[model samples]
Target: RIERLEEEKKTISDDIKDVFAEAKGTGFDTKAMRSIIRLRKKDQAERQEEESILDLYKAALGMV
Candidate 1:
């Protein structure tokens, strides 16, 4: 069962790579898309707090 599940995981991962490749071919920014996906996985308040801290750090470094 464990080995079968591992194979399934690899297949799903490969499928994800294929989809990202297709998106890239269509002019989508896969790196930004990955970041968006990561942010979407977080709760809204958590995401907002992270962004707020990032903005604060950027401003401190004059990156804003």
Candidate 2:
């Protein structure tokens, strides 16, 4: 079962590679785009956590 899952994962991964190749053919930098996407998600999550903490602090101070 594990072997089958691994094979499926490889197949899916290859399909993704093919898609990325096509994207690159269209002049897209897949690697940089992926990095940007990861960074954006990380930054967004951090900002969200910061906002949540600020909200909690305001509530604690009876300002919210």
Candidate 3:
């Protein structure tokens, strides 16, 4: 059972890689797409907190 599940997991991971490749071929920014996917998984409050901290760090580094 565990081996079968692991194989399925590997297949899903490969499919995800293929999707990202296709997006890249279509002229999409895969890195930014990945970041958007990650942010979408978070709750609004969590995203807001993270954005606020990022803004603060950028300001400290004079990148703001």
Q: Give the TM-score of candidate 2.
A: 0.58
- Higher-scoring candidate on lDDT, 1 or 2: 1
Q: Which candidate ranks first by TM-score, i.e. highest?
A: 1
List pairs with backbone clashes in candidate 3: none
Clashes of 3: 0
C-alpha lDDT of candidate 3 relative to the true structure: 0.99
Question: Residue 22 in model 3: shift from native, Å?
Answer: 0.5
What local distance difference test score does each model get?
Answer: 0.99, 0.89, 0.99
Cα miss at 1, model 2 (Å)? 0.9
**Predicted candidate 3 versus true structure: per-residue lDDT over 32-59, tens digit per residue:** 9999999999999999999999999999
Model 3 quality (TM-score): 0.94
Off by over 4 Å in 2: 40-43, 47-64
Worst 10 residues of 2 by lDDT: 35-44
lDDT score of residue 32 within candidate 3: 100
